[model samples]
Target: MSTFGDIFGAMRQVILTQARLDQLDVRMTRMAGDIDGLADGISLLRDRISRLEGIIEGAAMAASRQQRRIEE
Candidate 1:
């Protein structure tokens, strides 16, 4: 048989556990948003890097042509 004090103590623990779970849910939501922002940032960086690679490839080709002409 449970005493009143014992039941109250169990209820208190349950409330505290629920509160902690709610806090974790909020933090997880925020972390998900942050991850989405990071993904967007990474996508932008990938696009910029691809453009830079194209520019570098064009410059290399131009340099190679000039070298060939010089060697002729």
Candidate 2:
């Protein structure tokens, strides 16, 4: 028992809602890509930090040996 204007109004609302949903989907997809990029960057940074720590440890050991030699 709906009039033409009521039907048209309902259709318009449905279209607007669908468009909003589509826009949200696109934004979420982009956000997911950004998160993946950030994860990759973080992993790379962790690896570099680990390498630097190893180098520092080696230097410390060498310095300790030199100090011991001097004492003797």
| lDDT values for all models | 0.99, 0.99
Cα displacement (angstroms), candidate 1, residue 72, comes to: 1.1
**In model 2, which range of ten residues has the least summed lDDT?**
1-10
RMSD of each: 1.5, 1.7
Rate residue 38 of model 1 by lDDT.
100
Q: What lDDT tens digits, residue by residue, belong to model 2 across residues 1-72?
A: 479889999999999999999999999999999999999999999999999999999999999999999999
What are the TM-scores, per candidate, against the unseen true structure?
0.94, 0.90
Task: Find the candidate with the highest TM-score and give its number.
Answer: 1
Off by over 4 Å in 1: none
Candidate 2 stretches greater than 4 Å from native: none
| Candidate 1 per-residue C-alpha lDDT over 1-72 given as tens digits, one digit per residue, 9 for 90 to 100 | 579889999999999999999999999999999999999999999999999999999999999999999999
